[model samples]
Target chain A: MAAGKRGNVYVVVGMAGAGKTSFLERVATYLERSGKPPYIINLDPAAMRLPYDANIDIRDTVDYKSVMSEYCLGPNGAILTSANLFATRFDKVVSICDLRAQDYEYFFIDTPGQIEIFTWSASGIMITDMLSAHFRTTILFILDTPQCQNPQIFMSNMLQAVSVLYRSRLAVILVFNKIDVASHAPLVKLLSDMSLFQSELEGVSDFSSTLTQSLHLILQEFYEHLKIVGVSAATGSGVEEVISVLEDVGAG
Target chain B: MNVFLSLRSTTNHGTVLSPRRAFAPTFSMPYAQLVVGPAGSGKSTYCHNVHQHCASLGRTLSVINLDPAADEFRYPVTADVRELISLEDVMEEEELGPNGALMFCMEYLEDNMDDWLAEQLEGYMEDDMVIFDCPGQLELYSHHSAFKSMTEKMTGWGWKMVCVYILDAQFISDGTKFIAGCLQAQSAMLHLALPHVNILSKVDMLQDKSVLEPYLCPDHQRLANELDERMDPKYRKLNHAIASVMEDFALISFAPLDISDEESLQFVLYQCDCAIGYGEDADVRTSRDVEYGDEPDMSNLSLE
Candidate 1:
């Protein structure tokens, strides 16, 4: 965010099965084809394999399974603990990224599969704060476009996004993934007008619909400041729009 | 003037002289269940099915709608909150959002318990059975004083109440989600401080019923082990802590409710009945013993 900084850090977070890693891989490939190769950091220790080779992989330093056995944690706990263990030595990682900042214009981070493990965990906060203090950082929250067609699921995702914004105090870009399966225009329309959401829930008598409608009204301010874009990881569509929006967000 | 007076007196006398049933339905002890849970957990469906089941058994139960935002009902509503105040009216008049409007509506209902709710409930006999369909918002039962005060006021009215907490079985497909649901139920229990019955609603939609068997009557050890296996080792203490707290309180077991099955609904109803000590105050008749003369002594009959 300063005049001297050359690289912008993007933290990709989303619910499991939301195609966060796939989106990151698409971004990496796009950046490479344009001759402006981005620095990719794989923070998810539990990832079996990645689509693109990460320059700095947490799995290289921390073995997720060994951490599980060593700490007597479950799979999720192991991932979180591995992230925590990796976060402690993050200063070294930051120094490396800083050294390469002169050459790299963009940095992409793939968080854990489970959204809360990265968004709600202390290690997540520490890593985010460290990166933001050193570079221009943004949270790329991926939403499953098809799954978000259900208003209940959509509201839950919005609440999660709002919580992340409040906690991190960082600029957020809501990336609706899986555009190949469904269009995000309806969701975009719902976000722009509160009355549409009310009418959408008009058929249901469940109090939850009312709750969701009320939540939409309460989230109007959050929606106003949010930067939204739709992309498909499988088809590599909407990449240009995402990159342009990222540039706009980075500049503003 | 005399003719007019005589005509009025004759009408009054005729009204007084008309044949009427002498016996008014006497109630035993009023029983009520406040159906509460998160959104889309099937609270209304539960109320509708339970009301129908009770009606088929020739039992009378009143269904009351307490959600001001509710637009429709499948069962015949005995008393509706929309009559007193609605979320729409509150939002339009007070210039409040939906959540704030809902809170205001509930608090308004709490304030009018003496005048409006009492009058609406005045027709019930002493032993009437009633089910209140409450809002699905978590805050109503968690920390809101409206529900707590309403409970206090209802108790003062000599009504035995049980909180029927519902959880969507489909949402709790994993070990961690199950633990989270238990914790939420326990939180509502601690907050309301009432006789609580947790129900796993919409069990008919579950893909495998056997997967939920262990959760119905949860084995503390097995639950903790499963929870530990699912969570990372760093949260091992937290997993164990939750399991132990659940076991100590003995309040986390859920009764499964399958609306399509009568037996399942009956079992769920039985649990709620047990929680409120329903049917414990009935007066048993011993008229047969009084009708028959005394027989031979029990000692002589045993010797033979």
Candidate 2:
């Protein structure tokens, strides 16, 4: 990110049940097809099964349940604590990635189910910082299309996207997932056309919606800078575009 | 439970209302379940299952969507948080990150709980059975004050609140994961300070029920032995320490929920009801049952 990084780091994040795992799996396949076997990392200690085989998994170095019993922490605390412990040893992970940096062009990191667990955690901050220092990092912020169909939910989703974009300080690729369930055309319109969003916001009136209208106006510039696309993780449609966006941003 | 109900026959005569019928029709005090769990743990699914379960039994349950990002919920949402604050508005308005924005949304909900929530509750009838399918965000229940303050408010309003903490059946199938689940449940229990029920949800999806058998009964020795074998020798003491806490204090035990099975759902709800003392305050309905002491003859009871 500072200058010319060797490779790209794509951090996939979203609300729970937004098809993050499936999307990552599809991305892995797309990468493999392009002859770029991306280095994969699973940062979520509590995840039971990973759709893709991660080259470096936090589970190997940290046991979530052991963290709980040893530290007398609950499941969530153990997750955050385990992630923190894993973060301490993350320099080694970065070194390992460094060794493989010449062999792979892309690195895909699958985060935990809850977006905040990783994004708001100390380990998450450290890992991302370490990776970005050596790589051109981008956040693949996934939004479940159906969840955003409601004008209210869509406004919230965009605001969430802007938050991630600003926080990561990395180029963001807004991904509207589950297109098979719902079309993302309306969501695209709401994000790009402030007037259209205003009309839709009129139907949902509350303190929140009024604030949402103001956000629609304020985020008009943010909309101009973001790269958004739709893909059905189930069908694997539009997964290739994610890679293209990364390449374009990574090149620029 | 039967004893408590059958004893109701002896307490107060004709005007005495049974717990099952206590709030019916008149719509006196409200009872609610604050459904919470880790991500993908079926908090929303449980609400849907309960809605269907109550429907078959000719009862109605109101579902309040407390998650701003919620969509495609199976149950009808009576009240939604989007009315109060959207996570998007907070994010755009404040230029905070998604996590920080969500925290703001929750804090906003907490700040206005007395008024906004009270107005939200005005639509629901008194004595209603309500379910709050909360966001899967662990922060809200683990250490946060939103749910705790909301619980306090409801209690202040003369409402009976029960905290239903759900863990995935697959999550608890392993000994190590079981300990984690127990500790997590205890955190919410301590934080909310309410009657709590830790449930092993999605039991129907577990392939090998035997893997979860040890936890189903909470076998301390087997879990510790497995934990000891699975973890490194350096953590051997820590494993024993955690397993011992789970077993000794017995702070948590799980009720298995095979949501697909109607009986399983009923059993889970019944456990929650008993925890809240749902029918303990019902009045005596009949003098005939006053003669019944240790046992009521099953054959002598009228069908009604």
Candidate 3:
């Protein structure tokens, strides 16, 4: 969209243990094989070990463990502080990418395990905003398919996704990860057919369901705007669809 | 002394003549319960059920919808925040997202409290037990100062408030989620600084109700042990620290709410009553006194 902006940036964000890194690794391997290896940026300070080699890693700049001990903060606080520390110097990161912009067509950012640490924190928003200003950015919200089979859990994830979308105001692609374990089709079907979700909620017959039932009506507009792609990082399945969807988003 | 009155019909707003007459002097201050939780935690439904339960017993109660994002209501709202401002309208006009629009709507409501919320609250009796069904956004109660300031203003207006923190029973099925829920509830408690009651809402959805026993009155040590077994060894210190925090305060026990069972609902409401000292000043009554006139003695009153 802008002159001199050379690559499309995909920010991978999701709840803890949502297989963000696994999916990223899978996608990176695929891209590497396809002769278009994407530049990877690992932003998760608390990440124990990344499966893919990152071109730029926050952990290289900020020691999360030391930040925790020095500040007398817990794990979450340490991660937030570390992210904040990285966000302050994010301009350098943008410049570094800008220098190498001609070498790569795509940039993938791996966020922290704690979704809120990246999504809710001021530093996280600043970093996201900075990236969007520099590149064609899209959020890849990885959802744990098995965990979301439950209607209540599904609604919770939907709410969080909506919050993240509105907060960032970025184009988001709901990448339903771990479809190898649980198919995302049923969940997608539930979205399309209101009665199916209602009937599933009928078994519960509680007040929460009633509220969720009402929320379904409100979230319809949100769902209509969303682009969903089911992928199994374990099996390297359905990633092409994600790439295609990202391409479409980038083109538009 | 507490002066209990009959609930006016939802359609009988015009029939209420001097609603606050019997409540103002005797009670000196009214009472309120703020029902709040994350999205889909059954706040409005709790308010609806509690309202129905109280009305059945001929008690006067008012339910207020404080969520601007709320689009439906099962209970008749005495005062709705949507009336003054709505999330949809704010999002459309201000070009704000749902969360931002909600925050904007809340602040907008706060700015116009005297002209809006205060006036809407005036129609109800002073001592009528009011339930404010708040928005589902966790930030609003956990750390947001908007709700805190609003509640303080209401307190200044002579309304004793209790915070009803609801979590779905699904949370109890997992140890970590339950801990997260507890921490969220505690954060709200510290922020709101009100008499707090934690409700495990939608317990009826659980196939085995006994699964909730341990969670109801949590044993911090056992919780730690279970959490230790479930979580990775690396998180042991964190788990222990969390458990100790909960144990130190010991203010986070949950009341499992089964709305279908009248006894369960009463128990939950009774806890709220205790928190607010609802009937502490009420006149002593004999067994023969019928709380609701002409109502059948369906309840087996065991005279002490």
Candidate 4:
């Protein structure tokens, strides 16, 4: 649906501390080093600082501080208002992307750290929808690996991932990030070895169990076909695998 | 002038005060369950847990998978949007690719709500608890009206609704991240404008409980100071504002849930029930019969 050569658009999504920016930086660096740097787009109007360069930054379209001053709102309120404004004038972003029609192979959107802006706001949806309408978009859902070490926490992460998958309605590649710190091997193995995890899976049905089996079962059922990959931004462990997944999804 | 005079005369005659008919009280809960959070924040997991929890207690609950691109699920789904409109189909049939297909799927789901969703929900009982495992798209919950419209439609059907917000507990270990988490949670609460429960999920993974000590019982000023210390001085004003809003709204403090601990899970459930006023309709009773005295005359002439 996207114009031009149907550029690959991967939106990296997660909470503020979920290493989205870091992951994007790594991916961009990797792509750049590999002679295929993406046209990076910064959709986070509230971001004070970022590690990567953006071809089309939301700040150029709407000044966050101006909105805050005009509306007498704080940063969060201003960001939401600005995002709403962006949704109304989404053509600007499209035009910017269109301007770079032939230069880039992929367009990477580094969204706002405010999850609500990216997940719940109409503007965020419009952005994703509009971009996808024109390009090949794959949602790269990042789960903080350190957070998933706990069974309950891991289940919660899966649910959130499912929610995003449904909301975005895009091909989602679930990435368990920060593996260097937390070592998500156990959780990844637990998920991969479905048969071995049957008892634990059954425990998800029993709310009274010490380990939550219901959470596991829900994740298992929701992402039965998806593969979970572990990566560490700090150590760059398993980053290549994630890139390969993206490449495969893009090719498909 | 003549019409105005006639209206005034009618108003003065008290004819407008007609006897009102006694209307029957409506007794139906709205069927809208809003599961919201960042991608990988555990909205679906919560629904599945709730379903399993209900089943354990001998209750029937159904989950509707609304993510078209969803490839996995740990809970049994009664309905799936993927069956109707998959991203792959959109890409292949329409030649739209992944993102375009995704948007198409969402629009298709929205358009077919009456036909597809209604048909799926038709078999459910009036009070059936249905949890919709929504997509990982954060826009839907934060600012999108799709879920809001969906909630409105579900409410029309007879279901009590609640928004279960899950935030990773590990992210809350630090003061700055805690503030960020709180701000995000508050934004969702305000944006959705629904009954919400903020959950600090994945407590079992916290290897060091001390890291979360300050956040567990948050002191806004202390947190602000800690944030000030960590962040650049230029953002001190912003930090103060955030801390103030957090304190004023009391928004981000979550009921910690360690699914690994059964007691923690139950406690979380109890809190959720209380939020929805789940069991407030039971009749109250008092025993009427009382024997003259079971322990009689302790101070009387018994010894004498």
Best by TM-score: 3
Q: Relative to the true structure, how large is the alpha-carbon lDDT of every model?
A: 0.75, 0.71, 0.75, 0.64
Q: Can you write out model 2's per-residue Cα lDDT over B31-67, one digit (the tens) per residue? A: 8999998666889899999988777655667899888
The ten-residue window of minimal lDDT in model 1 chain B covers B15-24
| Candidate 2 i-RMS | 18.2
Supply the global lDDT for candidate 2. 0.71
Off by over 4 Å in 2: A1-98, A101-252, B1-28, B123-126, B281-304
Clashing residue pairs in all predictions, respectively, total: 7, 4, 0, 58
Candidate 1 ranges with C-alpha deviation above 4 Å: A1-252, B1-28, B281-304
List model 4 lDDT by residue over A1-252, tens digit each: 333536678888875557888888887888899998888888888676778888878888899879977977534456777878878887777777776757887788887775656765557778887877877888888878876654534544555565565456566788878888888778777765655555544543223332233334434544555756778887787878987887787776
True contacts kept of each: 0.00, 0.02, 0.00, 0.02
Looking only at chain A, give the TM-score of model 2 against the true structure.
Answer: 0.94
Query: Ten-residue segment with the worst summed lDDT in candidate 2 chain B?
Result: B295-304
Question: Ignoring the other chain, what TM-score does chain B have in each prediction?
Answer: 0.83, 0.79, 0.84, 0.76
> What does the lDDT read for residue A25 in candidate 4?
82
What is the lDDT for B162 in model 2?
95
DockQ of 1: 0.03
Separate DockQ for every predicted complex: 0.03, 0.03, 0.03, 0.03
Q: Model 2 over residues A1-252: C-alpha lDDT tens digits?
A: 356567777888887668888888888888898888889999888777788889999999998868877987545556778888988998998888888888988888888767767654556768887988887788888888987776655655555565454345566788899999999887777777867887776765333444444455435655666788899989988878877887887775
Any runs in candidate 4 off by more than 4 Å, and if so which?
Answer: A1-252, B1-26, B30-32, B123-127, B282-304
* Per-residue accuracy of model 1 over A118-183 as CA lDDT, tens digit each: 754568878988998888889999999998886645655665675566446577899999999999
Clash pairs detected, candidate 1: A73-B232, A73-B233, A74-B232, A77-B232, B27-B127, B28-B127, B29-B127
**B1-304: candidate 1 lDDT, tens digit per residue:** 3333432353353322112111233324478999998655789999999999878765678999999877779999999999999877887899754455778888899888767776676556554689999976665675566888787766655568999999888756656667756655654664566799999988888778777777877888898788667644544554555566567657588888888878677777777877887755432433221111222232221111
